[model samples]
Target chain A: MPNNIATVLSRQDTWRGRSQRLPRRTITTGHNNLDLLLQGGWPISVLTELMPQQSGIGELSLLLPTIKYYADNNQLCVWLDPPYQPYAPRLAAADIALDKLLVVRSKNHAEWLWAAEQSIRSGALLLAWTKQPPPRYADLRKLQLAAADNGNAAFLFSAPSAMSAPSPAALRLELQSLEINQLLLNVRKQRGVAGGAQLQLSLGEANTQRTNLALLPADRHRTYPVRQFNN
Target chain B: MLKRDIWLYLHFPLLPLEALLPQLPTEQAQKPIAIINLQKNIQRVLCCNTQAAAWGIEPDLSISTALALCPELELLSRQIEQEQQLLQQLALVAYSFSPVVILTDSGSLNHSSVPSNHSSGLWLEISGCYKLFKGYDALLRELDYRLRSQSITAVNGIGQNPLAAKLLCGPDFETQLPDQTEIQRRLLNADLSLLEINRKQQQSFKQLGLNTVGDLLALPRSALSRRFNAELMLTIAQLNNEKPFNAPRFQPANSFRDLIQNPQGIFNKESLLFPMKTLLQHLCQYLMARQCHCREIEWHFEPLIGESQKMQIQLSGSQNNWSTLLMLSRLQLERLELPRSIEQIILYADQFIEAPMGVFNLDLFDNQKTAQQSCELIDSLNARLGIDALSQPILNQDYLPEQASTLATPGKHSNTSLNKKLKAPQPLWLLTDPAPVHLRNKKLYWRQPLTIISGPERLCGNWWQAEQQRDYYLACDSNGARYWLFRETSSQRWFVHGLFS
Candidate 1:
């Protein structure tokens, strides 16, 4: 194939068409450890909702890793919330720099959604989030569309166990701390894989890795977490 | 090496998701679920399609209007926190398959983010995913399969870029790559309008004789940059997979507002409950933060000099979370005079203080549990069957059978029975209402009944509806049933009301 034809044709080929779908993408989550678990870092334009960490669970702890990852990737990581609260002190604990973090807090839920929807649609982040609950289908759908449109990943976190109902989400996770500092991450509901299991592990920060504790949920089997409700 | 980048767009119908919406009651989830954009307290439905059509509601319908169309609809409050969580879940699920997943909102997925009204969408760029998630087909299959479980309708479109992929999702339009080459040969041709070209921009482009990116590409890149901003340049760059960094706009700081809306124009008691509950909660929180007492009243009438300022508001009260606010709102509602068309309302208290009432320690935990259980039952029933479906018989002093019974409206008619002698520590499972039963020979007996429960105890309410208070009987039926059976004083009408489960 002639180089001239390939370049001009390729450029022309990408000329304004209604629909375009790239077949493959690299997943880059702003963290080395999580990327290992994900097989890739946060894939560009994918969505990841981080659960809150209670006690030592450190659910919000992962946000820093992902944010730092994005900052390293030269992508903007926005946090839409009360702004005053950021893991500045905690960043050093996770080997993260506070400058990589983008703080965004809206006056209300509507503004929050609006800002999130806009930010996610921009495709300019390793991650962006707000401490709000997505109680409506439209808001989720809108954010989903924005993520899809921008070809950028979006992360939305809700406080205090908000992922109760099945939403327009790809992976819904419920993270809690179990006995003796073991983290109980219930892939409560996921779109593609069966995730119903207790990803039990004790974090030894000194080593900076989550050692394999146990893949619980012997009776039921699936990839994505589907377990709901603690009986 | 920072490997070469690729972007993919996936589109899902917001409607087809019905089959996969998890275990939401048919009456609730199947009904048109409008994700609303609540502005200044007024909510507007954002997306509408065939799925919503099944519910007989259209896009742009007001929430109340949507309710009017589908009264049985299940409505989850519009909380962005929850919605974003859902989107994140979806994005993460897709992440498993595609390494690069760009999120996009359907509303703006095809529209111009740089030049348009700043629309939002989920435009996932799943590039370089061939090795990670098998292939595009596998990725799509997994995405569809998962979306179904969550009751989502997805429009799948595989294209070269997020914008192009989003445009490909719709079949009504022909999708393809603009320039022809072997790689572009497989691509479908699509109109530029599918990019959600702003009407104003589209007109401007047509006027300028630049119909498509192809036309714009024909111009020198330097001239193009000089003629127009990077908006056109960026979109062009995106089509070619040239990375475009979206530097977001600056958001200002300083937040927090303390205020309350009044509950005056609330005439229909049952209908007013939901709005009252929401507002009262907000008010209570406000008062608590201010540390004050609430005693007076103020109102912000609606249809203001500016219609958007919010209608006749219940303007007076302690903006604090307290049971008193609930009671005060109820009282104000009871005394309110409905205007020709009541709008927004505000409330303000004349005097209030840090009068934090002491918590009355109660030792009646056992009895209280049962009472709480009954209240929860009533609330759940109201939630399911609607408040209008509930009623109990209340008797009056009148001996006439016709004037002996009335409806025991829930949440109202607080005093059940006035006869102090009839007061006893009855089981909380007492039936608030009663049903008619056929007697064998003018004698009340449960021979054949649907449910048999508790409450032989008697009760009475406002006799305006109907009345006939008498000694009640707790009886069981032939089918292992339990019920509260009672006979009217003069009418001899046998009635049963509830079941204890």
Candidate 2:
């Protein structure tokens, strides 16, 4: 028996152990600098966690471009229990196809989780965004497993308090507002790569403002013609 | 042209027993049990299980005597109304097999002159349905399988007409597939007691040495009619397929309504599930047979001691799946607190849509099928939660930032249709109501000092109702929180409207 086992092990093409490879397909973050910082872009067919430092910090704006890309390709984008009502004019300004967007608000946590699980398992080329409390390890694992076969992406928005706790998400990032029309992204965890990378992104043209005024030479106390906005 | 109609008769020998079997626990089913009914002062047994029969107990025996024979017997009083409801439910099962199903009881044959003993059963005309079901044999096999699946014990018989079919379904006719000639032979060999005739007429037939139907048929028709009566002559003609009698066919109603009366009343929420599931399953089959779907169902819970409460569930789309309906109802029931014990539950449905005939795709990889399944999931959630809980943002044709957009119902309309024509960039999150901000010495205050990035986008509207004017700006506070602020030109007051993020 030992000799037969040795013979089988000596075969030229016998598969062994687990495979270590990464998914090649990715979705760009619409910011070239941030995309480069993440090594291509956010990988598709995985769960990505986005933790905002506080409410209204350009968190939704960060994902709008990816959402619009999918919508233009005739794919669905679902939002489960958004904190505030999505304003239509801004979505249109971002070139998002509203017909492809679905918003579901559940009455309680269980219903919200059920809707989220079902959306990921639907197998559509889509993206699902959900704002929820910090879920337990088992629930996150379930979503992760469901996303593996989803052939798309899912973004989970949670409070920054979840940073200290462990998670099963493929990628985890904290989005912070550094100044007006500028955001800082801190990657806390990611699959197939080391974490702890800070990247800066500039806002869109509408968010940027330019004003001209009379100017003076340097070292001379004077109000010169300058572009006045957040650094 | 007299058509030869083939009829199949189904006799449920144990419907009374089977109807109450589901209510019993598994351990109690193997024991001797008998259902008793009181007639004038004597408690007579209406039906008994095989275990009771083995203990020398049978139908029509006095309850006391049966108890004396089997000291450990279990007894339950018979509810006649429940038996009638079970008969109606059985008729629905028969309707699935043939379009023309007739429910037969003792007095259903009211036109007959004779007083024949007839048990309750179902009759179906299968001449036209044979080709669709491959053959009569295959159809019978399928019918038998379905009956046994429900734990019902039935006896079946086939004949050229309904009369012959019913008479041939005796206690010994468990599964008989007789042809036309075979049916004639069986009917002739049957005893004359099978006919519904007066006692005097039956005595005379026996006194004349006539034993079987064949013995009476051998005599001259006119002489027999003279000996018997005109009704007997008609019966004979009908049995032989010479006279065609239209058995009133049972037609399904356009809407569904059912009431389940549990005399003991449902004590807890768990007990209500049993009766609700039964009603839902029957309703699903009823709708499926008609190729229709219902959009809403109303449930009325009638308590024994209080005013009845009604709960209605509105579906996002038309549906007929029994399990899904059961699940949604379960969620609703779980959240309810009963005021008193519920004695009866009534379900009603009226709005229906014609369903297209198609095979359901069960494969998970089928994109359209999965999408449909997800839609159903959303509907189930909305049915439990109010429809207002789910919504999408849509563009409104107003100038005010607060009124320019609103949340519309999900899946009801295209949310993007109006947004495409808009030209302004609105904030993602708007305040529920504008909060007044303080501005002094050309400096904005929002819990801290704020700096203006740009702005003075002037707008005005709604002059017919209440005139409004404002200059909106984009600003941020020291904490890096961007806000949308507008100053009312009339009052010179500043208010926050939205957040950029």
Candidate 3:
């Protein structure tokens, strides 16, 4: 291969055809089915746009495992303009370190994008959400470049309407509720792979065990076997 | 064998003019300017610029004579305070070269060669610092370059002690010093007027046929001790290195406070950037010399009219880098609105703390470096936006969802632990205030009719306050969007409290 071509191909952001795929670094999504669908897991050091059909529907739950992974390893996690206040107890219960988490609320669209880009460039796991005045294509591209340069994962949450427009995100997934405990993920776009792949994942079971254990009274303790008096 | 100390003295011949030149307008600075001192009701010229000197103006010339010599000469009264401040600033520069720096008091030298109004001088003991700066020549060159960049002109001389160094510092001083024997030879040939003696003593020396230091040294020690006073004898001993010269070392200020005045007034906000950058650079240099970091800096802008406006920039972490500080200050200035034309700008930073070792690292895998970068980002964001824009979620020991968690300053660790046993999963997003849900057709409706996927988890708390008793449920809308809903038992009102996302 020509030296220039080789150098260009060596870049992490460069995508090749499936027949000559390059191995990329990724963080496991903690779900076997989703990981299988993503080949390994969520691609690292790139933008991942998660467009849910509506609010909730287990959208944030899908990222809880990834956030916990980074937070546990002492990496910073920045949340830009989250829709509502992040429930601390829920995050703590999921074993995510609160100290490693930074929540930033920007006053305007420009500041929001600036904060998102800065967070990504700092090599933090960035989770940003777009508001009524959605970010433009150029803004998302800037964020994508920052993530690729810093080698950190950035997940952007936007309305489902964004799925119709093209984006610079390496991975674009449309999330929907398959059932109360299950979520359906449609791969709208992905790098170096064919898109339109769908996967139904059961996310409710992970928290169901915790909820059941929590239903038990706080005073409940393991019973000790009574020793009969020496007859 | 004992090693001899090498001393370097910096003499500022035109310090009074140079000290105030930065504040003058360009057009005015280009004209011939002279600083005058009043002694016994007689005003005499103390220092003059090259333009004034070209017109026959010299130190000790009467003001009237100087004016007659050049009608365009601009006379300024001597500012002792400004001269002292400039000396301190110069000392800071010298301190960077060597840890031992001494500041000479102005008007302290009574020698005929030294002017009565000559500003203070700086003495640096550079014997131990030769290797650090490669060599004495390189050290001198670096010091000269730094001073020139600040638009300051200084003459330097080298000797075995402070007095000898001061005597060697004249218009004929050499940049490269000679060997010890050669230095002694030059000192012997130096005129007696260079010694720290009054005019009467110099006249007495002249009458006694003592023209050069060699002539005086050629006399008997008993005759010299009997003829000269104690001060002159001590000065001679210090000059010969037979006696040690003891002076207090210069200590850098603990805080940084510098002011830049623009006489013409800065009408545009963008015009303040240059002065702001200069001040920040000096501040960073001061912090580096002190081996500390400043967490907050306050900028006071004195307008031509009205009260001065104050802007304080706070950093999430301590910083000592000039470019970082300048960038942060620019971001803040972009948002500030000046009330009137700014006449002066004062930068003050008093809260300094010792910077942690290895605050910057090149290792890609270092966790501390990553944390520091995150801190820098937080600071930038907070500088442009408000400080309250950034926060970290912290859990509180309370049953109510709103009370269970609150936002705190970033990096603040909360001591409240999660209630492990209260396992009903909380939504990831909680509304600041619950929105009431409407009931239509006897079904729960929030934007649309909702279906309850799970039952009530009764939570009752805040008995001391307006008590709250609600039954929480997980519900989904027609579009499969899930929400956290609750119904108040007393009011029978259903509301949407959070989202699972």
Candidate 4:
């Protein structure tokens, strides 16, 4: 009986309890504690869903390090249907190569999905946001397959309400902010791992302040000479 | 020892009729058809299909006579423009086999029964290329197969000189050539009527008892020059390889333009894809032959009832592959809603760039492969969506958040450096226009009540233009959403500008 059990365990398709024999490839998430909570870092070649409770909650800041890593490696990073213009100076300040970054705005849901699928199939790190008439479950499955085939990471952002909906994403995280620059991440789904893992991360500038010298009374009323035009 | 040159002549006897046959309906194309031209104020038949000839209506017959012979004969006026275009297209096909291809319109030299604009030919210098195709037989076989696939009827001839090649191309001429002496013997027996000389010259030859080319060659050259015209002497010199036959080398068109007509009128937009694919394949062949790549292609669709519609498909990068181009064209066509049935489709591409050498490289580790894939994805997206749909974020050196960054077309590299001197962290998303914050009961309310976290970082610049002064802050709403807010010191009004996410 012991010999039979050993042979069965030696098979390549054998599933082991409490541990994964083939761990997924990952890229660091820039935060040590969050990386540790996710078991190494953000998974590669799979869909990772980030559902933030609201906008402006350090969600993009969390992925900044990974995006920077891809851009630095001369790989393309595509942003599809972002809600607002991605401030280039901020990304540039984060050391992301602007030339390697593509921002695609699709006119309709179908175009958006097509662009997302094409981006994933091209092996580019895709970061897409769900808009009106959100993608169906089948669309996400297609994207997951594309990501798996291309061996690239694709991150999808949706409203926090999507946390309860079924998703094909390999990793699903519910994001909320405890305070300014402080993000709380609850792992809702993870393949081959237990769910309900949570971590808190301090994201942007923690303690930095600059005096409002430009708004002082003397500068408030500063005036400049107007240029004269000849007729 | 110097090797002699070998020339191949392809004579298209019914080019005028064949060029216009593709534009006709299936039923109309099968009936008796004849191409007629005005000769001395008389409508004379230039060329006719076998169906017409079966009714005893042959070339040089008057139109009235032709009508009498075959009352159902369909007479079409000779189209000089179409014939020229078809000749050029054939020259391009011949160019694929040999580098030196010469296009000739032998309408004037043809028999009086088949006058000018009725026949055309392409001469290919094949001595250097036959070996590349393995042998002369294989080369000729391949050429014949290509022409046959296009429904082109050509008379093929081979000779040591261009004139001999043309003269040897008879209705009963054999493709297989014997020794040089046999070829000479055949050339000697060729009738004087086969020569390009006019009727007057032919009569002069017959009056002098020179019926065969050998009979004329037997006469003294000085005597023949004194008796015959300069044109006859020139023809003799060219046939004997004494004078060089120098015509312009065929240059493939810099741009690709081809037209396809559907008399049945394609009603469904999807049906247009089949014909569009064929045109794209031809365009790819043209590009490959020229070693060039095109970035834009204009598709003009002429409908039966409405004005012609034009759709342009522009690629982010120059591409010459048929599959890629066809895919892009398909994407573009899917979005086009045709108002009427399409009668004709003209594909034109003028902008061409030399294809890079690395484009054909199959090296696994070639870094350009990834870049090319990225460009292809961008092109595919842009084709389905508008060109403005895709862009790259570029940073600018300025103080204002809106002025510090801008959107540029994809693939544009930015060289501007961010102002790192600002210590405060910048927001990830910025609104095109700031939203005003409501102050109720002395509390900042933007969707909800806001609580200031830490800011008051002043970003005051552009004083020379609009003279602006504002105090910026980092604030959080009741839902824990961080907002980049600012208060105009002059107006004492507050607005939200960006999101920290």
lDDT of 4 by residue, B154-190 (tens): 8877777888888778663245645678778988888
Error of 2 at B67 (Å): 5.3
TM-score on alpha carbons, each prediction: 0.29, 0.80, 0.89, 0.86
| lDDT tens digits, residue span B367-474, model 2 | 445545555655665666557766667766778877877777766664334524434445788876888888777798866677887788887877664438888888
What does candidate 3's lDDT look like per residue over B1-501, in tens digits? 689888888988888888889888888999999999886579999889999899999998998899999999999988777777778888888888999998876223433323344746888999899789898788888888898898888888788888888887777324575788877887788888987677989999999999898888788778889988988888877877898877778888878898888878999878888999889888877887788899899999998889998889888788898889888888888788886789999999999999887655555566667767777887888788878898999988888889888899875676777756655667889998999999898999888789998879998887665449889998988767778999988889999999887
Could you give candidate 2's per-residue lDDT for residues A39-72 as a string of tens digits?
5555666788888887677888877777776666
Please compute DockQ, using alpha carbons, for every candidate against the native two-chain complex: 0.01, 0.33, 0.51, 0.51
Displacement of the residue B67 alpha carbon in candidate 1, Å: 6.6
lDDT of 1 by residue, B9-48 (tens): 5444343232123324345554556555554457656555
lDDT of each: 0.45, 0.73, 0.81, 0.80
Badly placed stretches (over 4 Å) of model 4 are: A1-23, A28-40, A72-75, A205-231, B38-45, B48-74, B106-117, B130-132, B170-186, B207-215, B363-366, B411-422, B440-443, B477-481
Among these predictions, the greatest TM-score belongs to: 3
Model 4 global lDDT (CA atoms, 0 to 1):
0.80
Supply the global lDDT for candidate 1. 0.45
Model 3 chain B: lowest-lDDT 10 consecutive positions: B106-115
